[model samples]
Target: MRREQPSTQEAADDRTDALRTEATSSIVGYRLRRAQLSVFQRFLTVFESLALRPVEYTVLVLIADNPGRKQTEIAEVLGVKRANFVPLVHGLEQRGLVERVPSDFDKRANALHLTQEGEAFLAHARQVHEDMEQELVARLGGEKARKTLIELLDRLT
Candidate 1:
């Protein structure tokens, strides 16, 4: 008796199933990383037209919400290294989306703010982000489950 070999699609499906049952599946950090990757993919899809990276969007929001805050403070709050964050700020500044002014309280520090164009862009980005979040919450079984997951994740941190 001869046995038939699995087709290409069948082999791919088996590999996918294997990944689901992998040892890392039981680990919280691994699972969280996988979830983050999935969510970030969705974010990219939703934000494709905006042409902004995830960190860029967050930086815009932070500067908009806390105008006149020092650049270093914003970078610290975001857990981004000062060296790495300077390029991000510079790119936004070059795009005319953000500005850095000499801090009144501290002459050595540079305070951050969004330009008019940045504000308008952020308003649209916020709407897109909210819509994407709503889609994620709905997929996660609605507002209650979303809130519970957020609380659990908060506890983990």
Candidate 2:
């Protein structure tokens, strides 16, 4: 039987080729959407267990803390378009978690207020939101990780 032997440089060349292939595979464009969606999915898991979406949670908290805030102001703070937020506000109203009272300053505008029921719901939502924040930090690591990611996101936006 005859045994075939491979040269050392041939093996070295093979290794270099493999390295180049792997490097090419690694060099790709930003996977921002993939990473963003992953974060959102984790958020959804925590939010779904509660009875509110993240947006609703935010809205509830804002209303809870800033009673008599105008809907337009809330939309501004959230950086959401007023047109888009109208339906979200309506949904909260339908759930009886919030009420829209006519603004004393502007007859055409409405000021938002958390009713007694809304306050109760907001309290529970706050607890859930806090728990979710903890879990998010845990998954993403400590403050540094979150801050770094937030900075990167701000740049992208």
Candidate 3:
């Protein structure tokens, strides 16, 4: 008797399982990259409609939480190049989601802050991100697994 061929989805699922069982899964760099890809895919699904990229979301959150922080300071914490950071901030400024003002302590450094519009947008964005995070937590098994994974990752960082 001849066996039926697997469907495309079945083949893909098999391939995915094979990837998880591969030696690369044991490597921190490889595993982290694969995990980042999965998380970013879900992030896109949640934030694409709002036209928010991950870096932008991080910047928004940072500025909202640390109002008056210098652009350079935020860039440093996020490990973004100054050249790249400028355009990111510019895009947010153009969208009226952020503003820069001269720092009171430093004449040269510009302090970052979320505009009223940004504050409102961030509220919705954060809710979407929370939903995405819950989805990730469920997929990773449960809250315990999520907490353990986060703790492990934090140790590395």
Candidate 3 Cα deviation (angstroms), residue 89:
0.4
Candidate 3 has an lDDT of: 0.94
Per-residue accuracy of model 1 over 26-136 as CA lDDT, tens digit each? 899999999999999989888999988899999999999999999999999999999999999999999899999999999999999999999999999999999999999
Overall local distance difference test of candidate 2: 0.82
Question: Which 10-residue window of candidate 3 scores lowest in summed lDDT?
Answer: 16-25
Steric clash pairs (candidate 3): none
Model 3 lDDT tens row, 1-157: 9999999999887784433566766889988998899889889888989999999999999999999999999999999999999999999999999999999999899999999999999999999999998988999999999999989989997
Error of 2 at 112 (Å): 0.5
* Per-prediction TM-score: 0.87, 0.70, 0.84
Provide the overall lDDT of each model, using Cα atoms, as 2-decimal numbers.
0.94, 0.82, 0.94
Clashing pairs in 2: none
- RMSD from true fold, candidate 2: 8.4
Clashing pairs in 1: none
Q: Output the better candidate (2/3) by TM-score.
A: 3
